[model samples]
Target: MKPQHPSVRRISECFLKPDIECLPQESKQPYYLSHWDLNLLPIQYIQKGLLFRKPSEAFEDGHPFMATLLHRLKRSLSSALFHFYPLSGRLASIINEHQASILVYVDCVNTPGAKFTHAALDLTISHLLSPVDVPLVVHSLFDPDLHTAVNYDGHTLPLLSIQVTELLDGIFIGSSFNHSIGDGTSHWNFFKTWSEIFQSLPPDGDDIVSISRPPIRKRWFPDGHGPIINLPFTHSDQFKIRFKAPELRERIFHFTKESIAALKAKANAECGSEEISSFQAMSALVWRSITRARRQPQNQITICRMVANNRAKLEVPTSEDYFGNVITTLKVSAKAGEVVEGGLGWAAWKLHEAVVDNTKEKFREAVEQWFECPCTFRLDQIFVTNSLSMTSSPKFNIYGNEFGMGKAVAVRSGCANKFDGKVSSYPGYEGGGSVDLEIALFPHNMANLEADSEFMSAVSSPPHLFHQ
Candidate 1:
C-alpha cells in the first residue's frame, strides 16, 4: 500500500519565497569566503545499503519506503524554504524535476540473501533534515567518488577513481551550493531536523541551543602567511595519487571505554608522566603506527595536525552560531627515530605538551600569524577525537534526529579527502559506551600502516580494539 500523509503542492506552497537581492558580503577571512564559494556547487556521491526482502515479497511495487521518502522530501523542501532562508539555498538549483531514479544491482547472479540498489538523491533532503551542517552528514550524489571495486588474487581490490560520475550508483539529486556553507556537523544537524519534520515531529523550535556567534571585531589584516590551497582544476591522469580506495579503508574502528582507559594508563606509565586524555593517548598510538609503517628512521620529522573547533575561541558574537568552517589546525612535529626508539608513551607526552601549550590564546595567535606569514606549511596529517562531552551522543535522544530511518550508524567530515594528510576521529559507536575511531590516509600509506605487527597487535588485542 502507498503511504500518504502530506501533499507535495501544499509543501511547495509553504516553501516558496522571494529571493535575496544579493549574495552576502564576503568576510575578511579568505577561508570563510572560500567556503561560501564551494557551498554554491551541488556536490554528489552514492550511499549503499544491503536491503533484506522476504522470499514471499516481491519488489515490483518499487521501494514504497523510498517513494514515501521522496514525497516527504519534496514537501519538506517547500516547507523549509517557507520557514528558513538557508533551506531555500539548498534548492536554488533544480538538478532533476522528477523523483531521482533508483537502480538495483544483482550480486552472484541470483543470490537469495539480499538485493542491492542505488538511489539517486539530492543533498538538499539530507541537509534540511539533519540537525547540524557538518559536511559529513550531508549525503548526496555530488560528493567526490573515492574508488571502485576490482577483483584480484581471490580478493576484491579497490581501484582509485576520481571520476565522480563513475562513482554514482545511477542515482542523482540536485541542490545549489558549494562546499563552503557548512561543515559535516552542520549538515548532520540539518538532516536530523528534516527527519523530525518528515515524521511530523516538532519543527526545530527556537530552543536555547548554544551556538557560536560570529566575530564582533576584526582581529587583523591578511599578512600572506602562505598561498591558499585551492581545489585543483585539472584532473590527474592516475587517480591513485588523487583518490584512495574506500573499501580497504576502515572508515570507523570500535574501541571499548575500558580498553581506552587501559591504553591511557599504559601510556601514562610508559611516559612516566601525569594523566592525559584518551584523545592524546590515541593520537600518540596513531602517530607511532604511521611512522613505524613508513619505516622511516628516527630523527626524521613527521607531522601530526590536530583540528580545533574555534566556536568559543573566536571574537564572534555570543549569540551567533558560528557556523561553517570555524576550525583551525595545530601541528606537532617529531622525529620518526625518536618515536620508534622512545615508544608511544614518550610520543604521547610530547604530543600532550604540544597540544596543551597551544590552547585558546595560542590558537588565536596562530591564526593571526598564519594570516600574516608568507610561507605555506601544510601538515602531513591530522588527528581528530570528538568526545561525547561536546556533541550529544545519538543514543542520548537529546534531539529527535530519527528521520523515519533512525540515527546514522556513523557520521564524519566530508572534507577529509581534500587534504594531503590523513584525518581521524572518534565518534560514539553503537552498543553503548564503545566508540568508533575513523581514519583516512593515502592508499599506499594506509596499506603500509595496516601491515605493522606492533600496531596491528595492539589494535587487535584484548584491551584496545573491538571489531565493528
Candidate 2:
C-alpha cells in the first residue's frame, strides 16, 4: 500500500541524463551474482535521507528557491550517474537449456538511465524534527517498493529511484535501491560520491574515479560452487504480506555517549571481557529486552542474527569501489531464561564470540561451503529458525552525508519496515559516541520493551534531539 499525503505533489520526472549521446551505450557486460546475493531474497529497499539548506536564502532575481535548487540537484545527479552507469541498469536472469536452473546477472547492456523525481510537501522541518519517531512523510518521499526479479518486466522499473522533496525549512533527499545491488556500505559509498559531485563536479570530466570510484566488476566465484537455486514466487505472493495501521509502531531510541559507555562498563564488568564492542553490548541488551517483553517460555531459545559485511573480511583484495552484495549473517543463540536472568556482559560475550569467530579465512571457507549446497535463504524463514534479524551497519557514515547544504539533522529507516522484531541502526545524527536505534515491533511488545526497566535506564532522555 502507498502512503497518502494531502500536501505532497510531484514537480517533474526525468532520466538522470536525458542526453543519450553524452553517454554512449557500452558493450554489454555480464556480471555474475555472488553467493551472498543469490541466497537472500530481494524484497527490501535501501532508503537514505539527506538534509539540505533552508528556504530562507534570498532568491536572486526573485526566482523561486525550490526551482533553482531542484535544477541544481538534477544536474549534479546526472553527472554522478554518468560515472555510475551500472546502477541505471537492470537485473535479469538467463534460463538454462534444462529450464531447471537460471544464471542471475546484472544486465548492463542497452539499459536506460536511473529514475529521478522532483517533489515537495506542504510541511515544515519542525514537523519532522518534533516527532520522536520519523514522520510518515519521509516514507512517501521515494518510491514505496523495491524492484525484484519476479516483477522485472524488461524495461518497466529502473534499478534505482531518487526523489528530492522540498520542505518549508529544508529539502529531503531520498534514494531507494534494490537490496541485491549492494549492502549499506555500498549504498553510502554511492551517496558520498553523489554528494561530492553535488559539491563540485570533478575537473577531470570522468567523475567516477575521483568521486568514490566506479564499481569494480570483478566477480567473486569460489571453487565447487553449486548451481543457482530458484525459489517459487507468485504474483499473489507479494500481497501475502500485509499490515494495518494499528498493527505496529516505529520509534527511534537514542543511546548517548555517556549512556552507551555506562552500558559498556556494566556489560564488560559482568562478562570480564575487555574486548567487548559497543555493538555487542547494545545488541545483547536489545535482544534480552525484547525476549523478556515477548514473555516467551523460559526454556525457549532466543537467537540473534546480524548481517556482517565481508568486504574487509575477504581474503582476496577488493577495491574500495567493489560494489554489489558482500555480506553474510552471524547467528548467536541463548536460552530465554539465561538472556533474561544473566547480566549484560553474559549476553554480550555470546554475541561477541559469535562475531569474532567469523574471521577472514572463515568467511572464505563458509562461502566455498555454501557453493556445495546452494539454497534460498528467505527472510521469512527466520521465524521457523527463531531469531531477531538486524540490517544496516552502525559504522556507515549515514549522518555525515554532506551535500553542499549541510549534514542531515536526522536519519531514519523506512516506515514500511515496521515489522515485528526487525532492527536497523545508524550513527547518531549528533555524531558523537551515541547510536540511533530504529525498532519495529507489535504495539504491545513495543510498549513492554519501552517499559523494560533495564532498557529504559540506558535510553537517553527526550530521544537524541534533532538539530540543524
Q: Which parts of model 1 have CA positions greater than 4 angstroms off?
A: 1-63, 77-179, 201-251, 316-320, 370-400, 410-421, 431-433, 441-448, 458-468
State the TM-score for model 2.
0.87
Clash tally for model 2: 0
Which regions in candidate 2 have their CA more than 4 angstroms from the true location? 1-7, 17-27, 53-55, 58-61, 97-99, 145-155, 202-209, 212-214, 223-246, 383-386, 416-418, 462-468
Against the hidden true structure, what lDDT does model 1 obtain? 0.38
Error of 2 at 2 (Å): 18
C-alpha lDDT of residue 205 in model 2: 61
lDDT of each: 0.38, 0.68
Model 2 over residues 45-129: C-alpha lDDT tens digits?
5666765656346235575766766666776777766666667777676655454555555666556768788887878777766
**What lDDT, from 0 to 1, does candidate 2 have?**
0.68
Where's the lowest-lDDT run of ten residues in candidate 1? Answer: 150-159
lDDT of 1 by residue, 1-468 (tens): 523222111111122321233213321112212222222222221122111111212233564654454455544433332222332332111122243311111111111211112233222332322322223322222223221210110011111111111011121222222223343333334444444455663345522122222222212222442223222222211111222324223334456666567668888998777667676776777777777766676666777666555556544423223334454445677677887778778878876886678667786676665434312211111212211111112222212344344433333433323322343444453434444454544456667776877656545322211222
What TM-score, to 2 decimals, does candidate 1 have? Answer: 0.55
RMSD to native, candidate 2: 4.0
